[model samples]
Target: MAGGLVAGYVLGKLYLLLANRLRDHTVSIVMQFVATFLVWILGEQLGLSPIITVVVYALTIARVLPLRGEAWLRVQRYAVWDVVILVLNVLAFVLIGLQLRLSLPQLEGPNGRI
Candidate 1:
């Protein structure tokens, strides 16, 4: 947990620094996505909560990235984030469905009853 939090903070700062140095908006957006994955995987490898790590990293970036970034970049970033949100929502629903499926047999009644 400690390692995850530290890595997340460093990752966000590194991404922000790179984004500020670079001239291309596309690269900056892509770098943010890459940093998110890196921090998430880092947290997983450290045996901690990847969600917490990613959230910290996102919160760090949220304060400045949108305000400093170009309007076009913001638009593209919004689109990308929208897709990510959709994918995560679908994945969560699928997980719930799977859990329901696993519990159904027990709920169907005991003693080999259908």
Candidate 2:
């Protein structure tokens, strides 16, 4: 997780630099994928859940300081698409969980039995 976070931060910074120079969203997304791959690899090495590690790393990158005005404007322009993607991602998670029977444990009484 720590390694993922570090890699994510580095990747985000690198993306910002590249975006500034190239003015390309494709490069930014590619950098994000590279960061995610790094997180997955590091998580596997550390015996952690890769998906969870990558999600945490991605969220850390998202919440970093130094927001850009142009990025904000772009986000505003694509807010609807963002919402759609978020909903689709959530639905995918739900479906995967259901398929895997990975629901929360049923609440149990004082007996500690479900």
Query: In TM-score terms, which candidate is top?
Result: 1
**Looking at candidate 1, what is the lDDT of residue 39?**
85
- Each model's lDDT comes to 0.83, 0.61
* lDDT at 19, model 2: 47
- Look at candidate 1 and give me any clashing residue pairs: none
lDDT for model 1, please.
0.83
- Model 1 worst lDDT window (10 residues): 105-114
**Each candidate: how many clashes?**
0, 0
For candidate 2, write residues 1-114 as lDDT tens digits. 566556555555654554455446555445555656776887788776677666766675556423552665456435644776899999999999896665445555578765
Give the per-residue lDDT digits (tens) of candidate 1, residues 1-114.
786677778777877887788678677668777778888998899887898889888888898888988888889889988999999999999999999999878776667665
TM-score of each: 0.76, 0.44
Displacement of residue 60 (Cα, Å) in model 2 is 1.9
Model 2, poorest ten-residue lDDT window? Answer: 64-73
